[model samples]
Target: MIGLEVSGGIWKATINRPEKANSLTAAMLTELAEIAERAGHEGARALVLTGAGRVFSAGADLEEAHAGLATNPVWERLSGAIAALPCLTIAALNGTVAGGAMGMVLACDLRVMVAGGKVFYPVMKLGFLPQPSDVPRLRSLVGPSRAAMILMAGQKITAEEAMSWGLIDRVVDAEALPDTVHALAADSVGASPAHATAIKRMIWA
Candidate 1:
């Protein structure tokens, strides 16, 4: 359930399984990782990760998680691929982000969410550890204490709270999400890949 569109040096990947809250499966995660990896080599100046429904992702599909997807290396591969991209990466969070899905979202250089979207990782409750690389990124964005509030206390943070805590970069209504993402991506998309990469590294640095 992954859809990708490439135009004018911008790559937009969408998770298309909204019926199950866009929960990811092994194949879907693999495709996402492949897309991220390809974007790095395919001259993409900007890459946007987004979902196709009311929820970005409820994380891994429950059945698949029970069948060993919980500890799959693909999760790390996907997040790492996105993290290693030289071009700018943006997570256009269409809705709530939960569980293992937090990995890819946190790996992005920028995050913009729709209004009323919530963010949480229920690893403690679900008996699965958070994805390896996700921890430090999460900690970096929201700080140790707030990260503890979500990862340790299993707190569900709303979009507004996430913004104040430094998690979400921008929050806008659903209708405005596309425009917001487009605006954020325009400059990067228009630049050469190497130019965009250099600026991204400087900002990230």
Candidate 2:
């Protein structure tokens, strides 16, 4: 499921399914979309998406997939909401990210990952394609060549490689992750909220 907490102008959303490696279900995706919408309406200065345990997310739940539950629409809605939030948004990747979860990571305005964490896209291996919206976003962040490496080659990009490719903003030791994200949130909270929102919208436009 999704866990939400708001304090000091920062909203945090955590995927709380450690036993399953935080693999998202239909209900979880719905809750996440609602949380993202609420964060916007409540005028939080910053929003952070992370996982409860070591794995950020294992992506869509295969069990749900077998049950004919299509997660694409809900996932799209959630990621879109995160991307369109007026305030700054961050994906504090506490650990590895894989599959459809990469869309959520890419949607964030900035990303900070643990040094040993990795990002793996299994599109080619699984015989699936990246979402239409996700393709351009990934391409814009890391360019077409790297995007190809991820989508076509099914590459597992290490934190250092991801940082060098411009996919992630920062990489820090696991123990420093929380403090780093807190400092970033504090800085965003100190900025002029209205200006930050306007600039973010303008840049996206």
Candidate 3:
């Protein structure tokens, strides 16, 4: 399940099926994409993607992955929608992130993770190619070799390592995570929609 909260020009979308390690289903992916699209169209100044539990996501749902979810186009749609948003988008990594779940994280303008969180993408081991845009986005953040280390060798990296590698922008205590996100979002949320979007465009340009 996905939960969305919008207030004061900020849109927060939470992946809520923590019992499943927040793993996504096709329907969930579709809903996330729709929410991202709506955030863009509805003049949100900031958008935060986060999970409801200790683990951000373990990637696609196991049962669904076995049934062709691994290669689904919905992954691309969701990430692309997030990437296209003019709002300041952040992936507030509540905890570990693995497999296809990293696609949306990579699309974000910033990634802030809990101090002990881990990140890994095991497409090579799983025999599935990542979403189309994910490759370049990931390489841009963490560089080619490090990206290869995760994708090819399936090496799991800690939050500090990910931050040093440039994949994660910040690593903070779990208790401080919400305040950190709010502070990072404050200026944009307080700005005029056009002003915030213009600055975001300039930064991404």
RMSD of each: 0.8, 1.4, 0.8
Preferred candidate (lDDT higher): 1 or 2 = 1
Clash count for each candidate, listed in order shown:
0, 0, 0
Off by over 4 Å in 1: none
Q: Name the lDDT value of residue 75 in candidate 1.
A: 99
The list of candidate 2 runs beyond 4 A from truth reads 69-71
- What TM-score does candidate 2 reach? 0.95
Work out the TM-score per prediction: 0.98, 0.95, 0.98
User: If candidate 1 were superposed on the true structure by all CA atoms, what would the RMSD be?
Assistant: 0.8
- Give model 2 RMSD, 1 decimal: 1.4
Local lDDT at 167 for model 3? 94
**Which portions of model 3 show Cα errors greater than 4 Å?**
none
| Residue range 31-132, candidate 2, lDDT tens digits | 988988998898889999999989999888888854643335877898899988999899999999998888888999999999899998787887666766
Q: Which pairs of residues clash in candidate 1, taking residues 3 or more apart in a chain or in different chains?
A: none
- Residues 81-155, model 1: lDDT tens digits: 999999889999999999999999999999999999999999999999888899999999999999999999999
C-alpha lDDT values of all predictions: 0.94, 0.88, 0.94
Residue by residue across 86-112, what tens digits does model 3's lDDT show?
Answer: 889999999999999999999999999
